[model samples]
Target: MMTNSSKSTLSRGITALVFLALVFVPVIGSRAMVQDLFMVLTLLVLALNWNMLAGFAGLVSVGQQAFVGIGAYAMFGGVILWGWDPLPAILLGGVAAMFLSLPIAFFTFRLNGAYFAIGTWVSAEIVRLSVAQWKALGGGTGTSLPKGTTKDMFGVPQIKDLLGVSSSAAADALTYWLALGLAVVTLLAGYVFLRSRMGLGLQAIRDNVEAARSVGVDPLRLKALVFVLSAFGTGLCGALLFIQITRVSPDAAFSVVDWTAFVIFITVIGGIGTLPGPVVGVLVFYILQRVLADYGTVYLIVLGLIGIVIMLFARKGLWGMFTEKTGIELLPLRHKSLQRSER
Candidate 1:
């Protein structure tokens, strides 16, 4: 009979194998493949962060692009104006977004339900408009990193020297590794958080605020902290994403559809309130994008139809559907135990 500990061990073993496969993908796969995976991983990070905010914390923000924009611009400013290194500037970008998220969260949290969602979207637009006025960073037009700055990006020099690849290839490889690291960290951190006391409290609050409050869950503090953390992680993803593109513009950086809408759709369709949901959602989304991108408007219509179908039928997302059918959780977070039968 498979006990809980044995099941956990099996899960961990499978996870280790998957991790190893991802880590070596760049070595064997084409550079284009690496870059594609990088994009997928970044989107996965966004979906995960948004899921945490909306699914776990009950803060259904529709303006997460606020952080993504600011984070990208912050990294741009750090590298262009302050001459900070690229990778380090990405970290600073996350910090800047976190700092900004406090005020945004403070104001938006005053409302509830749809009002809160609109308020967040409005705040993000306000930020996008304000950022458009900065002339030094190319104002409304946008800007690209200096060639010299990009050539020496973080570990690219070493990567180029070691791999005997061109500067661009080496750079792609470095960013691919960073994206992999970020995805791994984000997934692991989320799993750990969901298993913690605070995470349990957050879920209680999400289910019933008044009851959770009565049970000693500090709803206000918990919600605010999660809001800021989600912004921080989203900001980090935005920074890293633009770093790979080597360019930034207010419009592109703060795109609600690209950074917020797609992420929300992916999360909801993947299965909210579950860790593996975003991972599965991103992969499915990426595949659809690859297959249907040539059709443009038709592609979008199909995507919408699929989302509607999944939501109406599956509701729990692909992973959720699987678990409902098989009772298997790859990364189980619930604090429950399986008791052995007494002989």
Candidate 2:
């Protein structure tokens, strides 16, 4: 039987191999494959951020779409209105989302449980409506990036020259690589944060607010930090996503079904509190999407049914269930006891 150490080593090896393969995909893979994987990576980023907030921080916000929209719109503003490149505009989107989260946290933090969720959704709607009024961006009609904007992005030409690919393909590769980097950074940062002292405090607050307070945990501070950070990540992802598509509309950017509900489904299906849950959930979701694409609304119904089944049978999600049954944790959070000799 493998010990916990051995299991961890094995898991790390497999993860490294998978990421290594992913990194080279843009080089050897077709343009279509790169695009598909880009979608998967962006969804994975959103799922990870949502997991950190709802799963660990105990902030069940249903209005995360607000940040996505804010970020996308901010990026669009940077490119069209300010004449900045999309790469730097992505950072602006993240910063804008982080700032928007402050007011959101101030208000929604006052609510609890179901009320909190509803408050967040309402906040998102307000943001959507407000953004729709920005006539310079085409008001409710939305707008598109200038032609050749992406082709002329900073890294596109270098990628095109190096890979001997068309400008469009090069642009796709650059976006794909950026998405890949973002996913990696988000996952690693989440893992590190979850294992830190503050992370333990956040989880403690989630488990019992009063008890955590008794132990000197600042629930509000920790919760606010997570909310802002998650917003930043979601915003960055949104900007990157729109950059690839080179278009943005308020309705499309802030769609609850696409940005929030799907993310929640991914987190819940994979194992909300576990770090690897989103990764596993995204794979399952992608497979389902591919298999059910032709069935229209039936695809959504199937996703709902699967989510229900998982919640009823395995509330901890697929990754949680696997760890429970196999006693193998690829990413264990619990600290092990020190041996007497070491002590």
Candidate 3:
């Protein structure tokens, strides 16, 4: 039997190897593979943020699509109206989403439980309707990036020269690399935060708000911080995603089904509260998508069924189940107690 330390070392080694392999994918992998992995990485990012919100912070927001849409629209506006480059525009998108979350938090925080969820959904709908009135961005119809917009994006030229690939392929490579970097940063940051004192407080609040407050933990503050931080991450992802597509519409950008439902599905099936759960969930999600994508509504039905099964059988998710059986954790969050020896 492997000791805890040995299992931890093994998990770390495997994780490092996988990350290293992903870094070289653009050089050796085909364009199709790059595109598929880009989607996977972005979804992973979304899943991670959602897991942090619902699973850990107890903020069951159904309006995360609000940040995504705001970020995409902001990026498009930066590029089209302000004549900014796509890279900086993406940053602008994240900032816009972060700012939007302030008012959202202010209002939604007043409600509790399912009411809070509905409040978030209503907030997102309001944002979508408001964005649809911006006539310069094709309003309700939406708009596409101007000609040569992406080809001229920062880093595209350098990437094109280095890879000896066409401008489009280079663009794809640049976005893929960005997505990978974002995923790594988000995962590491989340793990660190969750292991911190504040993270413990956050989890305590989730378990029992009144009990946590008795211990001097500030529930409102931590939940608000998580809300803002998750919005920033989701916004960055939305901006990056729309940049690749080179198009934006309020409906496409703010679709709750795409941005929220699927994300929640991934988190639930993979393992809701565990840090490694989203990664596990995304792999399963990707495989299911590949196999069921051609079957129309059957794909969604299958996904729903799988979610139900997981919830019924493995409440903690697949990762949670695996960890329970194996007594191993790739990213363990439990606090270790110091052993005392008699002198």
Candidate 4:
């Protein structure tokens, strides 16, 4: 009988080793490989935040793109208008998203279930349309970061000094490291939260809100906390994403599919409510993306079909199926006792 803490410690050790290895990936891997992994890490962060909110908090939001767009636009505005360093602006973008989420939460919290979902989506659309009219950011047309500004992104100079690389190479290295940090933070934070007192309360609410409230869980406060936290991570990811692209447009910044839809697909297919689920799901998604690249929109159709099959056959998701077959928890949020004596 190994304790959950022992298991978590061992897992953390292994994860640390893996993280160390990844830190060196940018050193040996080609620029393209780093770039591709950036996409994976970014999406994984988005998926993790969404999974935490929906899977743990029972707040299924479809309008997360609003925060994503706001984050990106904030970064762009900071760089273009405020003349701030890109790095600090990225942090500001997250702050801006957190602030935006407050009022939206106050409004959307009034609705429940499906109405909440739709209200969130409508809020996102309104934001996209409003951002589209800001002529300074090229209004509806879109704009790209000047080469000078891109090259001068804060930390670029320091990174160049340390790595002895060109500006473009330094940029990639810096962004790759940031992506790596964000992904790790998301995973650790989610796991920690799920193992916390609030995590227990949230799980109770997930199972039965009335029961949770009866026990003094304070469902509204817990839900609001989760919502604000989700906005922060999503907004940070959006800023990092647009930083890589070095350009922004209303459509691209506020893209529902890229920011929200794919995230949902990854979480749902991976096994909602499990830490390893999103990680495995993102890997599976990338594999499918590579294989189905030439098929155009058919890849999406196939995703839908797979989702339906999973729902019908294994409602808990692929990781859930795996867990049912073998009781292994890569990131354990649930405690178990094997023997009655131990119990």
Candidate 5:
């Protein structure tokens, strides 16, 4: 009874559920394996958020670190200063970052192309300088987080018995699981949003804002929504980063390079505007990082060279090339009605 189009939607729905399940699997299973898993998940979220803004929305914001720092500081403030719980503090940080992006969106949405990028970069620097000067939160020196409690299943000690893992390891693993869950959730949200009407508006706007406007698409609102959404995820990633480090300094909190470099590289290498691009990029990048860990700057230079090569050969990127060659999207976000002829 199901048509091909229905089949594609069903398939996508199933995949989304599976990805989310993968994110939480570590939480119930074991803690020793959580840290690395979480880090990868966080990176995946970061890459995808960046891709959504730059790839789909056509807004290449170079100053996303503004939100990143805000998120980190929010968490740091909650846990360290207000004596709030870590989890709640982390969530608040992400929310605060999203809210903070609204004003930036209003200001920068008027500019187009390279000018927009410049505006964002300048804004980020302003945020950085302001945070740096705030001595109340340790200013540039950074502050540390207090140790928090851990829970286990059936009222057992999570680290000692329920997971059969060491306390520190268990904590690290839980953070990883949280990051993974967020990444999966963020991806699913993007997938669903793109499949809906708003997503069509976004694609339309991206293709040609003037035409989209003629078609009744509000480019400003769409851009603002995507901008805040991107900030939300990036902020979440920053909060997670703070948890992992248990310390926050203006320098590290607003590390522009950390937010920009890997994400741009990942999105570019994986495939801009494609769901699987960030995942592919992260896998390739992690491999390269591991293999080249000993070489320091040389490793970075090599990564740059590889990125250049990929860009030069396939302007569309690795995932784009794969999509072109195979006509299959492993993690397709855009819902297309299947044509019998193509089938």
Candidate 6:
């Protein structure tokens, strides 16, 4: 027997889960438009993780590509070196990134703002150089994984009937689903933590370190935890990206330009410090890309101009503008309830 409060919470959880499950139906069930949606979902997940780090934690880490490259490399290393399955390898990659983040955090945490950002970029460059020099893992030339490695690693039995995709496509689909799940989980985790006592401390610290410390918050520990988790999330995104390409090279794996640029753009364009902003931004950018994909360099120039214009005129990002104008929010990070609860 559940109390009314418990029942209400359960219902909401169920409803959210059902909605998530529905997102997959069109992809796995429908034939014409599944792949495109899956790709966009993957980008959305990337944007969400970036938002958690830069938007929420106020850590502008340019070397997020470090974790991304590490995760992709870990995928290959785990399967080839340890015979671990792909799914577990992906998780392993995330864990590895988290552990690695500790040392990086220790050093960079001493710096503030722009210096911290520069430190991250320098660290990623070091990683790229090291990987390029190392010959065992194929280095700058990159390496390839066996076909069906992702499916085989995850061990999804009845892949075809269950997913309604061919074996080759199934692997990609599964990776997309994994990214989608992580994005939702990351969002919920952020919301839950923000609502918890610790979240209050973090927010306080973000606002003013001296004030928060006077109130008994440990800024260092909180910042470290967020940095570690941010690395883990970025690494997980990288692993999914590796699954999509089925190949890894130092150049592509450590491609800061793509992962970092896309995520940073999405976070800034959507709304910094807001949960739903990055997701919305990703959708807008994806649509713009799809519509102008064939235009090549011209498309990129236009996007750059739009971004510049937005930065100068509307610095709050797209979601911030939407909130200011319409007051409608599909994802709320600051509040616990979907809508503002009146006392």
Error of 3 at 62 (Å): 1.0
lDDT tens digits, residues 230-340, model 5? 898899888877878787888887777777777788888888788778888887877887798898877678878878998789866888897786565665665556764
Pairs of colliding residues, candidate 6: 86-153, 142-249
- lDDT by residue for model 1 (111-198), tens: 9889999999999999999999999999999999988676788788898888888888888888888888988899989888878999
**TM-scores for the candidates:** 0.95, 0.97, 0.97, 0.94, 0.88, 0.87
After superposition on all CA atoms, what RMSD does each candidate show versus the true structure? 2.0, 1.7, 1.7, 2.4, 3.8, 4.9
Residues 109-204 of candidate 3 have per-residue lDDT tens digits of 999989999999999999999999999999999999998999998999999999999999999999999999999999999999999999999988
Cα deviation at 283, candidate 3, in Å, is 0.7
lDDT of each structure?
0.89, 0.93, 0.93, 0.89, 0.79, 0.76
lDDT by residue for model 2 (1-343), tens: 7876688788889899999999999899999999999999999999999999999998898999999999999999999999999999999999999999999889999999899999999999999999999999989989999999999999999999999999999999999999999999999999889889999899898888999999999998998999999999999999999999888999999999999999999999999899999999999999999999998888788889988998899988999999987777876777776754341
lDDT of 1 at 292: 84
Model 4 score (lDDT)? 0.89
Error of 6 at 334 (Å): 4.2
lDDT for 225 in candidate 3 is: 97
Give lDDT tens digits, candidate 6, residues 1-343.
6654465466568758966774665454654355566666666766777777777677888988888888888878887777778888888878877877887887788889999999988888887888787676787897888766766655455556675656766665666567668877877887787777878888888888899999999977877888888789878878777877789899888888787887777777777677777776787778788899998866667667767877899887887898677555544445466886663
Candidate 6's C-alpha runs over 4 A off are 1-22, 25-33, 331-343
- Counting clashing residue pairs in each candidate, in order, gives 0, 0, 0, 0, 2, 2
Q: How many collisions between residues are there in candidate 4?
A: 0
lDDT of 4 by residue, 89-171 (tens): 89988998999999999999999999999999999999999999999999998898767775788788888888777888889
